[model samples]
Target: MKHTKVKDLLKSTTTLQEVNAKGWVRTFRNNQFIALNDGSTLNNIQCVVDFENTPDEILKRITTGAAVSVTGELVESKGAGQTYEIQVKKIEILGDSDPDKFPMQPKKHSLEFLRENAHLRVRTNAFGAIMRVRSVLAFAVHSYFQKKGFVYVNTPVITGADAEGAGEMFQVTSLPMDKLPKNEEGAIDYKKDFFGKHTNLTVSGQLEAETYAMALGQVYTFGPTFRAENSNTSRHLAEFWMIEPEVAFNDLNDNMDLAEDFIQYVIKYTMDKCGDDLKFLEGRLLEEEKSKPQAERSELALLDKLNFVLENNFKRVSYTEAIDILRNSTPNKKKKFNYIINEWGADLQSEHERFLVEKHFKCPVILFDYPANIKAFYMRLNEDGKTVRAMDILFPGIGEIVGGSQREERYDVLVEKMKVLGIDEEELSWYLDTRRFGSAVHSGFGLGFERLVLFVTGMTNIRDVIPFPRTPGNAEF
Candidate 1:
């Protein structure tokens, strides 16, 4: 009989099940024991091989990470550490990896060291857990939206304009960076650039997704977004994935409802399918946060706040109200914020965001009608004249996981906002045409996909969630 996976066999304590297994030897110890893993999980299994019963030549060839096929009798070992192990009956070497040249040995590596080797980092348990959780979350996102009848739309990677209106954009080029066409201002003429006229990788797909949602009623785009920001923080990456869903006839409140439901469903799905992985991440986060008790264990801290959000209905606060709460709060003294959180006008920073979700409301906070001046140009202007129908869904550990707004479906208002923001109407003529033809009231939000993975898996760093991180100054992988 072919041996089953060691991890699977360990789950069942059945005796005398003959199995065949093929995997890399994780650790060979005490002359007769082999610790093996088959890219299953963080925990590998210990298989006790009786050398006297095996071919000496095969035994001699078996080295750490050497691929071997093993025929074994499953035994519920009366062992001290592991519950069950494979009793080897036969062994055959499939391939041998040179232990010296290979980066990974049985020895442990620092996370910083592993960061240097992002390519092969997936072989490690933490990365495996992260990758698996990321995969499951991506599925959950698609499944959640698809089941709700949201059409999937693939947005462009390279585009003529930046979506976020954020200036940080990576230049796309068919020509070499050094040998680019220059004009009178000694600037490379971007008209000759790929796709022409200063095109760069997209920063968000919300605007494009809106074009479809106006027609399709409900649509979403899940894909890569790029930025050229040089800040090397744990959470910021040059290239990241975002899930932006736009829904026609949806107001800001409806958008929040969708956001909350989407978040809850994703969390529940992750917890259900990747419980072991989640637990692993939980433990991992606990370890990671130990050094920053103030940051981790603050009143409106990440873990506690996320657990609260995951378990309960989110609290709603108007941005104006949130600002008032922050201004009048005792906790504001501790935040040491440069910007005043006095009233309805300020952009909520991480500190103010933490205050509302973690400290003030002590629940997930959906604050709406952010100042029109501070918000993106596409947001619908509220009756108050100062605010736009933009909402940010902020959680405890993470600040704003989602940013969305009800779009000004009216052509004139949208055109005016775009003009005020100095967004070129000539470039966005197609977008304006949607309003001219069949534009309807629609709202959408951009959920930083890495942020969700970070929140769900308890991963703190943006680098930890992505397989091959593309932070500024580093695209090695």
Candidate 2:
């Protein structure tokens, strides 16, 4: 009658008289033992079928990827891998999958091959574990913010402003491309568009979240953000989720403290809740790394790496100090890095960041007081006229896990900075309003959700963590 999840059934203390378990058949061995998984957990429950009594036709339909419901008695399993097994009394095929056509079989599949079959990839053990850990981490994000009395705000996905000041946003328009309307100067008339102005998908919700933070005192947004960048690197994703938290009356130090605590809290929470999944991923990573040389392998295991972050304080270093460290480092001195760090104002790349975290510091590092010219327009400019009160939290594997800064609260300085950057005063007047009226010092940072998943799950590729990754020239499910 009532179906029990595989995860719950496996943990049962007493044997049940009759239980209904529904899941896709992972494998049917010897026409008697069935490995069934319903995605509730990483492990599958063994379902033993009586092939002598079952019809041959029904047995033939019990193929891999086929959905089936087995009514059976839950008892102690004689199997070695699992503790519980289902003694099936009746078998019903909810959906039949042809063994010849099903893409995922009972065998090892490359991550690349699984990426190609994104829709059906979750049936595999690795993807299933990854998705479970991802779900738990997402919940942990909200739990951390909510428990801290932070108001959850939903910023508009479609906005007229580019929060990051990067022009690589996806344009949202309803106007016909071929029959485009033009102005007197032959420029495309945005007035005829749906929003009556040029609008793009938001790159960050930080600017909008600031408005709420000013009134609400503390606010956070967890939502989808889009970028039109064409890079196909393992770290870059055209579409990804960002978790941004903006707080009022906070400075650079307060922002750093908030970010460090928030990150550690979420990571610890994920580790606590997704213990089984994390263990599975740890083993998966260990197995995967066996193919590589010892020098290239990660020194710490997945769980240990996570616990290390929780146990240690993030080393706080200034941008100037980090630049000095990088400039004198072996890679930069020997011209090994792709981008040399010889100058002060040069933007730090991933290679430089990894060196700081993994090699030099050997722990998470927060580099602050960035050069003003390289940072966004909203960051507070330092009195020295060279740097801004900005910071980036660098992780060992993931370079920059979080980016934030103490916002420019002074209206005059903000206007002057916008004028210098050629940013439209009228276009972002709404954002300027926060500074214009009672703008106290406020700070916020955006954490790339996918990157967090990538780090926690120990998955190398960013595309592997997010479902149905949208990359350049590829949008297949």
lDDT of 1 by residue, 250-323 (tens): 98889999999999998878778776766776776666666785754544333444568788788888877777
Q: lDDT per model, in order?
A: 0.81, 0.93
Which pairs of residues clash in candidate 1, taking residues 3 or more apart in a chain or in different chains? 2-19, 2-20, 3-19, 3-20, 300-358, 302-397
Residue-level error in angstroms, candidate 2, position 398: 1.7
Q: Would you give me the overall lDDT of model 1?
A: 0.81
Tell how far residue 173 is off in model 1, in angstroms.
1.7
Displacement of residue 204 (Cα, Å) in model 1 is: 1.2
- Stretches of candidate 1 exceeding 4 Å from the true structure: 1-7, 12-15, 55-57, 80-83, 105-108, 176-179, 182-194, 291-306, 333-344
User: Best candidate per TM-score, number?
Assistant: 2
Cα deviation of 230 in candidate 1 (Å)? 1.0
Local error of candidate 1 at residue 2 (angstroms): 6.5
